[model samples]
Target chain A: MESILRTENLCKYFGGLKAVQDVSINVSKGIIQGIIGPNGAGKTTLFNVLTGTYNSTKGKVYFKDRNITNFKPEKVTKLGISRTFQNIKLFKNMSVLDNVKIGFHTQTKTKMLDAIFHTKTYKNDDRICEERGQELIERVGLSDLKEEFASNLAYGNQRKLEIARALAVNPDILLVDEPTAGMNHIETRNVVELLEKLNSEGLTVIIIEHDMSVIMNLCHSILVLNHGQKISEGSPEQVRRDENVIEAYLGREE
Target chain B: MMDQVFSLIQKLRAKSVYFLVLIGIFVLIFPQLTDNQYILHISIRILIYMLLASSLNMIVGYTGQYNIGQAGFYAIGAYTAAIIATRAGYSFLLILPLCGIMAASMSAFLGFPTLRLRGIFFAFTTLGFSEVVRLTILNWRTLTRGTFGIPGIPLPEIVNFQISTNNHFYYLGLFLLVVMLFISHRLINSRIGRAWVAIREDENAAKAMGVETFKYKMINLMYGTFWAGIAGGFFAYFAGYISADSFILDESFAILAMVLVGGKGTLVGPIVGAIILTILPELVREIARYRLVIFGIAILVMVHYRPQGIAGAKAEGRRIDVEKEYEAGISENAVETTAPGN
Candidate 1:
């Protein structure tokens, strides 16, 4: 399979501290890869660098063969990369549907004048977008709450809604940061299943998750990070039994 | 059964069309009820303020930028119109656009840097700016005539016609208000409107959504201030006088209060607010000073009870029609998949 994203020694720093230092991992096309590490292992920071949420301190990031080391977040999104924040960032006061609609704004090309007049073209495109938004909402099983305030959604549904929102951008690769952070086991299982389903559709997914079971079960390949550096990379079974991985998780062994 | 009842309810609601028609007829016949030029003047003032409040609401309400220097733009407009008509001896038609440009340019200049600050900080900065503009007008005695103000400002003379009386200006004001209201309605329903709402709801998210946050914000400020300037010019010409005291912080606060009390983001809310508040003191002319006290009390009570105001809370709330359209689409599939036979 072709590599969809490649990072070469991607580094990010905070003053004297290196949050992500001399770390690199390749994500192949249509694979669900997981970056697993304990708290402060820089999994989220690495994800940020990939999605252009933060500019890299050094090194290069290539998305679909194009080196995009320091593009802004929206520019990165327009280039077919999207992400969901660890803490939910939905437009809270807006309806769930509107929150989803905003993601599709990148795909829309209607002129301002068309929107002003509610012209035939504008109305037609708007109707199509509305339909597409509704479809995505249904696929995530939150169509029933489309008109509910985003702030009012159940925690699990909100996470699912975030995925649906990311998908609305029609991205080639999705960088999800801790989708199951606050979810219960059953919700976590639901999310794993959803990610698997999305991956089956040929959508490339890279997840940063702390849950060992979720990482081992859903991800085809696992990359382990310790102190902002990659320590191990291989299949789930290979990395799971690695000595460095064990040392990273346990800090010290008997 | 529910659908049937809902359709029937919709039919009953349609009866409001006839009620609105009756009101339209009454409004047409209203001025004939009293030939009092004072009443005509009051009506025209209310209409002008309604237009101003609605325009100002676009910036403060939809874009989530609090501008307490709205009166500064108003002053810019009034002075531009006054100077052009009086000193340069320009035609009324020519001076209006010049006034708009002057106000818009000043608004963009102020909005560019200060928009970097958020919430209360932005509000206070604008308040300070209004004070600066007022002091400039006051101390620039040679240009603005200081507190002496401008006098004998010519009434707008059209082709072979002069709007020299309250009635003539009433028609002129009415025409402008209608044109402004139409433009506002179009603007708030457009892509720029969505950009404003997005910024208001979440500035970071708006930028992340590829919205040019600063550029759109400047545009919002420019549009709002441009209209306000024109309305201020209308006020100067109508009153046949211009002064710094008339366009003060109190007036800015009054307009802000109007938008808030009427529901900030709702299209008709500010108009309703301005009309009621502008005409309110006339009924209490006996205790005119108490008018401010009463207005203050009313605003406090309204905020405490209904912060959402008369029309709606946020822009999304007022857009029930769009939400319902989206909801309908969502419901069809959800109901279909969840239920085999519906």
Candidate 2:
């Protein structure tokens, strides 16, 4: 499979400690890939590095043939890479629809004066944004909660809204961290289904998940990390049975 | 159904327009009702403060930036205008906007380089910025005439008519306050406004969602400081004297107190705050030094009673935020089991 997002020898060090080291990952287009590891295995750190929250110590990242190493997080997002935090990062005070609209921020073309004057172009853009926000909310099945405060949504719905927000970016790749961290079984299933839905709709997803069931059920490929190092990378079935993945990740806690 | 909704919105718009017109008429007639110069004078001061507090609202209230250095911009505007108008014999009309741009540009110049400071760090830096501007004016003997300041600052003129009365200044204050309100109101309800709120609520999330948080924040600072500078220009002419002594850090606190007492993040909060705080001291003038004590207590009570200010949206107290939910769990997984396994 052709890689849509590739990271080579990425390293992130905090003083003496290496949070993410010598990690190379290639997420293919239109595939739901999962990054898993034991706690402190650097799954979230890897995701952060991929999304440009923290600069990689010594490595390169290429997204869609563009070298995007150490771009600012906003630049990364504007370049069609959007992410959700491990614990939901919804604009809690903003309405659900507004939350989704914020994801469309880079796509907006209205100038400061247009906003100040409510010019014809501004009105048109505002309407278009509202319609697009509504469409995403509907796609996520949060149509009924469109106007509600993001913080007020149920845990499951918040996860769905986070994905919907990421979708609003119209990203070429979606990096979701711990989407089902605090979710129940049904919520997890919903999230799994939502990731599938997004993948089916032609989005590439790179997810950090502690839920083994989510990884096995949803990911086409899995990369297992142990203490900031890539221990295994293969199809879900292969990684599930891989001796290294099991010993370092799956069997470590068993 | 769409037609009904459109017409309902139309009715609401028309009603608000009428309400605004009525308020405008009342404001215009207020001087006629009370020929007392003291009252008109205070009203003018309140209007100028309203502009300052409302402009400050663009940062503190809406943007959620803890910028207590409005006096820095205010001083810059005043000094730039005072220095030029005194040296070049420029009209107040030309000088007002120049002052605004000067402060706005200064704020942008300062804010851009130090955009990395988050929350309170930025606030302290801004506080320091005010001190720097003040010290420069105090220490610069050639340009600013040191502590003596520029006296006999010219009054504004219209069609060669020198507007030397409190009543005329009232209109200028009203005009600028409306401008501040209109611009801020327009921006806050639009994408720029939404982006600001998003940044305020969660900057990382806003950035991750593609909002250039720094750029928007600088714009907010520029817009706010622009008005503060303009208000400073008004203060220069209004007081008929320009002095660094008046542009103290205490003025910054006073503006902040207005925005907070009125409410942070609300359209009407600063106006309400500006009015109440501006008038509160005048009303308590009978008690002399006790007025400060009373004013301080009022601020204390207001802050204690309603941290959200009077017209603020959302719960003003500490929100049960998602910071923990977003990044807290990452470190906790340090010693736990391996990545989940089926």
| Candidate 2 i-RMS | 3.6
- In TM-score terms, candidate 2 sits at 0.91
Predicted complex 2: DockQ: 0.50
Q: What lDDT does each candidate get? A: 0.80, 0.84
Query: On residues A1-254, what C-alpha lDDT tens digit does candidate 1 reach at each position?
Result: 79999999999886666778899888999999999876667777787788777889999999988999998777888889888866666666677887777777677755557766678867776786699889989988898999998867888888888888888888999889889988999889888988999999999999988888898899999899877888999999999889999998886756
Model 1 scores what on Cα lDDT? 0.80
Second chain alone, TM-score for each candidate:
0.85, 0.87
Per-candidate iRMSD: 13.0, 3.6
The C-alpha RMSD in Å for every predicted model, in order, reads: 8.7, 5.3
**Local accuracy of candidate 2 as per-residue lDDT tens digits, B42-143:** 999899889899889899877788999999899998888778877898877789999899999999988987767888899999999999999999999999
Best by lDDT: 2
lDDT of 2 at B153: 80
